[model samples]
Target: MLHTSLYCRSFPSPSHLRSLVLSSRLFPSVAVRTSPTLSLRRSRANRSIAMAATEDNRIKRIASSIRVIPDWPKPGVMFQDITTLLLDPLAFKDSIDLFVERYKDKGITVVAGVEARGFIFGPPIALAIGAKFVPMRKPNKLPGEVISEEYSLEYGTDVMEMHVGAVQSGDRVLVIDDLIATGGTLCAAIRLLERVGAEVVESACVIELPELKGRERLGDRPLFVLIKAKGV
Candidate 1:
């Protein structure tokens, strides 16, 4: 459970609220307004169509900011680099604001960020929502008693570690990363949180490579991503 102290903060101001509402309007599938005459299914379908259109526009902005390098780390690989996105303040803020608006009132008590890139996006969200930030680190990065999970990689397996007391039982957690390629890293973070009795509310990323089929590997856990790049 979140501390009562965290609940005392005021909601967003009217202008901020308008911005948040506008952002939701951009993703209508997730924010359909109720209508007395409309059937639930019809409303949902309308929202889905609106969401697709809005998401396409948003993806264009996000995708443009990213730099794609062909065969960088290895042959036949196209790396989507977010460092270019960071260079554009508005794009970077849009990425973070989208997450903040979605999770601000979600009752998320903790934000668990996967090692490096997650570290960049997770803290701002944690601060905005008054949630505690927990780092899911590489093995030995955390200087404390830790629990580690070994996950498969393309060529081999690697381990991620977290501090023993970073999360409490029943904490509602959101996992954040810059991107999802193979899904193994996010899965490892989810396993670590669930192992400690924390309820993982969702896993989020700025970008997703759907070709990798990472979402299928998450089982029932929901994945929310801003942009999906079909190829690179």
Candidate 2:
């Protein structure tokens, strides 16, 4: 199914062969022995390249599993839909595995999921790492006394609320959501967590809309995302 062509050239003598090999950057070590440090560096570089290729493959599979709907809810809106991804067991598991393996030993005590979509990915990650899952709801949807932060939306502004004791002071937290667009919702979630003296470890999302420059909106908070795409 695939073919690679090989080209050959003649070397008049052994000296000519050595000169040709030395002249080519690809055959740097062919003509002479390399230092141990140089050999180690080359080995590390090769391993890194192989690891990067594997990561790229995983990203492609997760991206392909998602569905894109054009002009969704309103015209001019390209929605990155993940319900299709959830239906594919392998893709969905792989997506979650990336997050779980990264934070399993990071000492994340609380995993906060933002509103509706966050509810989907947060629990499994928390369960995997033995962390508690807390829901950051909207308005008075959460019972009892709640902390609220109003964030700017594309159209207007909305409030995100959290229960009084969901996250304790000095608790380490990892914020979770399905996607990050303008980053308003995630920033609000961060504000709520910090107001209680909790340490916002990092934020994680499955998809990101780089065109919106949302990652820049988070300031110093580290935002980890799997797939980067436009109009999503």
Candidate 3:
């Protein structure tokens, strides 16, 4: 005698039963399916969300206290003057915090700021991260045995100097600059650091000019920029 229990499935119809059996046999490994276009759309949506989050964080951190000056350094150069950002208490603090956060994990033995403008941001980051502050000065600025590297600027050429004994062998350094145009100054700073037996772990800047490919001269060294201007 056969024992029929509730577990025994009842067939809907002969034709329906046959169709189900044929489908199962033909495609036994079939799983959930979605069109390729749908998958692409989902991936794009995820990327957009990530990008938006990054942009929002940047906006909140970047000081809107900057002033725009029409051609103070040169004609037709709209300088994005940051004197206001420097004066404001909160903005200045935020700038230092951002730099410190970016380079905290870079194992920086020293923070080297290039020339005049770099002096503003570099020492603060060095203090915050517990690293020694090193200065990259102009020609004849520091009175000691020095190493110098020269490179061209947008309008002319300039040389940067550093004290020979500023960085010890096997030390890791981070170079900071206000802006990177053709990257001449930044490259010189890298060479100066390396000349004294220090390894430049990374370079940080406030702005990058992509059109000029300012970063290309340094090969694959890590670079970070807080903002990029238009046409770059």
Candidate 4:
């Protein structure tokens, strides 16, 4: 007997194809996920990636704000001028914010700033972290029983002075500076702080000259830098 129905098979309707079955042995691979753990993990991964991208963008913005002056102090020198960065409100605030964010919870008791440019960035950072600001000045700049450390420079040597009893024993100190060249100034600051029995938690700087190998002189002390660029 000829039967047309025997040759035909049923096809899934549009609604069935679009539906998500909680459990289906026939289509187990396409069944809806019963557990939320995988979803949560994926969500967390996405947020982490977004946060990293935001941080990178902020660093780029801060780096671009600095002006590069050619042959200013001498010939063949590419000076990184942060004064231009200061002109931009967002950039300057961002720079300070980055430093504060890192040390706010570190239990830093004192913020020791290297003379000149460090004065500009150090006080605000110190104030934000509720730490005392101690100025590491040039020779003869600080009054009243100051201790001095002489460090080697590219050509010769220079002296840095700090007030007596500024940072006492057991004080956790953070050294701040604008730029690091040959690491002479930062090493001197570290020595001065350690001499008074203070622990140099770490050093912070806005710019770094990697080509000069300043980090080599810094030794085991961790240095946090916002930007790495050649200034010579």
Name the candidate that leads on lDDT: 2
- Per-candidate TM equals 0.76, 0.78, 0.71, 0.83
lDDT scores for all predictions? Answer: 0.87, 0.90, 0.78, 0.89
Pairs with steric clashes in candidate 3: none
Give the alpha carbon lDDT tens digit for every residue of 1-232 in model 4. Answer: 1232221223256455454342244445554444689888989999999978977888999999999999989998999999999998988998899999999999999999999999999999999999999999999988789999998887899999999988999999999999988898999999999998999999999999999889999999999999999877
**Where in model 4 is the C-alpha error above 4 Å?**
1-43
Q: Model 3 segments beyond 4 Å from truth?
A: 1-58, 61-63
TM-score of candidate 2 versus the correct structure, residues matched by position: 0.78
Q: What is the lDDT of residue 17 in candidate 3?
A: 57
Determine which window of 10 residues in candidate 4 has minimal summed lDDT. 1-10
Model 3 / residue 140 / CA error / Å: 1.1
Error of 4 at 229 (Å): 0.7
Model 1, 41-125: lDDT tens digits are: 8988999999778656666777799999898888877888999999988788878878988999999999999989999999999
> If both were scored by TM-score, which would come out higher, candidate 1 or candidate 4?
4
